[model samples]
Target: MTTHPDELAGRVLSTTQHPWRFALLVMLALELVLLVCLGAARLFLPNVPLIALDLPILLLNAIFAALLLTRLGWWRAAGFRALQRPRDLILLALPVALLIVPALVVGVDVPPFGKALALLVVTLLIAFQEEAIFRGVILHGLAPLGTLHAVLGSALLFGVIHANSLLVGRDPAFVAVQVIGSILGGVGSAALRLRFGSIWPLIALHTLNDFIQFSASQGLAVEQASPVLLIAKLGISSLMALYGFFLLRGTEMRMWPVSAQSAAAP
Candidate 1:
């Protein structure tokens, strides 16, 4: 459903005089909170890629989603709505192609059924949380600044948060590669989220992509970022970002939240 012009969260961000500044703080604050939560999660779960590692984040996402619905009786600009146009279905192509790269380059094996199931669940939640906060909250907060800033800002923050993996004791090289990949994926995902005004399809693509990569390692994906793996991701991710920007370029630029909210008014 579309965001109402009077919705508190959207109105607050879009109508605020310093939306750019507010958006920066909001994104940074989100990253900081999630990072600290990850670090704390490791203290208990310790194992990398734990399903529960993201439970807290999911809780946060649920709470945010609930708050918005309570305020407006429907989700607003949070990528909650389903894909609205049949033509938007084409937007999935680049993301899916980008995700398939590592599998083709390095190959993937199906993990044991239990492990695969677990990864599926974990990655689904992760995709949900990331899209909601990154594409949903951050995009809405920055939408007042115009579509370009919202897309770029969310993508950059998506990359930045991957740095938290280093804090969990990952190799710097590996973390660096992850950061870059996240940014590229983020750019494409953010652009598509705005275009399709939905998150379910992106969520599915993200879960499958990560599940394959994680399964490929049989566990060491956490411990290593092989040179070949890094190189393959960089190449494909660059193409993904390019396609995303091109899609964005084809669309007319506007203050997204403001325009959307205004249109929703009867």
Candidate 2:
């Protein structure tokens, strides 16, 4: 006999609430798998552009995350629905708008259509992998800690993941700044995930934001930016963080609602 989705979700909720050690281990294992995949790709595909190499690795990671969610009966918790509450969507838009400042200021040169398409695909895959791990798994596992702690904890993990940038030889200061930005973005996206009970919008927004930023980095001259532009970027990042906190204020965490049929299943 088949188990209902709600029944499976109930089991997931119950299981994740206790044995905190196991939950933490699961979280670490997920991140380690992702890191290992990335390392392998970098090691084996040294000649490929990082973006190109990352696409396949991220796709594999997303598949792994999906399988884990399925096994845990929390697959529906992904919240893929669109057309959520207007207020929540509006609040989410604040940071989405702010995220484009870097691309707008630096400005992108039109790349060959093929390269542009490749970048878009890469960014979309990145959104899938990140949202699946950070929001779907980590945030859900930490839900027992209450909304504030879960949000902060998951965001910290998100920031920590960016430490891989150091391996790429990015300046320590630059990677530090990126980590801060990731934490802020994590909070905002996590809020949206909770508020709307969906990760679809976050995926779309993340894809767009990353695509623009990546495109600028590849096709624009942001490396030699003026101090004024740097200051503006920092100011925009601060606003995004403030808006993230604004979104999180008064929010409460709860399990995603299962379907009526699933809920009634016995």
Candidate 3:
């Protein structure tokens, strides 16, 4: 029998297990890249624009993701498939909708056209790098643990990793909101990736979400706006998490084909 491409992908990529040692090394490599970027920024580009620093960081992540992909032998699994259902599109848009209220309330200053274009480029890179690592490497590595575990594990890691924002002296309240929001957003993005078998829409939605948030942060805004906005944001995020959970429960009995027997085999 001919296997569907998606099924084949799940069997070939999700079933393959890397050594625990390799997983630890990949996670360590990510941290090292982050430390190097922050160190370089502090030592040399203290006064540079945030994007100037972020661009190099994003580039390093892209390089690391590429290496991880090769090391894991997931070339076929990384294919960007088309969205196959209407629900897939809705899941992709849900995260963007969550940001709409905040964008309206905070409002953004119109930057010069060139600067705005440059900012968009930087945000796109940020989205690419983040999804490639969290949703790509981490998700693939953890798939044998079952979809629920993989989804929640990756999401929690995503949130915890953002704690690094505190090191830059961001307000505690702001960092807390960001970290929580990231965890919630990670659930939705990971579900959409699994459901649609593609990362393109996630990248687009993530870019839009980040660009709006980044613009609002740089523009004029009331100091009190964050807590209120965060409350609303978290509510929406909870709904998203619920939606992803329901979607997973309603789908095929197995999200990936890594059977318990295969998972335990040498």
Candidate 4:
């Protein structure tokens, strides 16, 4: 009997000795790349906070993204196609609007024009790379586990991976906050990726949401652990994540089929 694609994926995952470990390592490796990029940025650029970090990040991430996209099969599975349902986009508008609340509540500092421009550029790049890796690659990879496992599992992975930031000099307190917020955002973003069945829209929304927060007035560097700001971040991110779970409440049982190569046993 011929197995359905989803079933085949489930079988592969089931038969694997350490699928979860492999997946975790992949995520860790991805973060390692980012850390390397940041290191390169520091070595070369020296200290323009915005450009120094942003430029190298953009370079490495953009290139890695290209490698993923170049493979026809990988790109298709990664939600590279046009939106499968336009209505989902409309439904997502509400969450997208609410996403900016953290920034508004915490306040924004609007860096000098040049720095703001660089920030915008970097955020856009990050949105692309992250959505591709997390929502696209990782989400689809976990598809065999059914909607709940796949979506939530990937979301947890997304959030946990940010801990790598601490190794690259981010403050421990700030990284803790970042990981919490990331997990929340990941939950929502993963759900949305499944809902829309396309990654582009989420990328756009992620870029906007990130741009708003990173440019906030007090900033993570100074806030350190502002109770008020942390509360606001939790509330906003949680709302979006809950809305995401709502959106995907009882959809496909398990159908995140990947490209031929992606699903292959190594």
Residues 81-171, model 4: lDDT tens digits:
8997787679667776686654655566678888788778878888888888778766766676678877887788878877766655555
Give me candidate 2's TM-score against the actual structure.
0.78
For each candidate in turn, give its C-alpha RMSD to the true structure in angstroms. Answer: 4.6, 4.2, 6.5, 5.7
Error of 2 at 242 (Å): 1.3
Q: Which ten residues in a row have the lowest lDDT in candidate 1?
A: 257-266
Q: Which run of 10 residues does model 3 get worst, by summed lDDT?
A: 257-266
Q: Please, what are the lDDT tens digits per residue for candidate 1 over residues 147-201? A: 7777888788889877877655566787898899889878777777777767777
lDDT of 3 by residue, 49-132 (tens): 443445676788888887666544453344344556756576656566667765676665656788778779888887887887
The CA lDDT of each predicted structure is 0.67, 0.68, 0.67, 0.68
Q: Once superposed on the true structure, which residue ranges of model 2 sit more than 4 Å away at CA?
A: 1-11, 18-23, 34-52, 168-171, 219-234, 257-266
lDDT of 2 by residue, 1-266 (tens): 86667677576656556634545666677667757766876798777554444445567778887776766655555554454675666756676667665556666564689988877887888888888878877787777788888887888888888776665444566566667878876777787788777787788888887776656556321333344444544566677657667777888888655454433432
Question: Candidate 1: lDDT over CA atoms?
Answer: 0.67
Error of 1 at 148 (Å): 2.0
Runs off by more than 4 Å, candidate 1:
1-16, 31-74, 253-266
What number of clashing residue pairs does each candidate have, in the order they appear? 0, 1, 0, 0
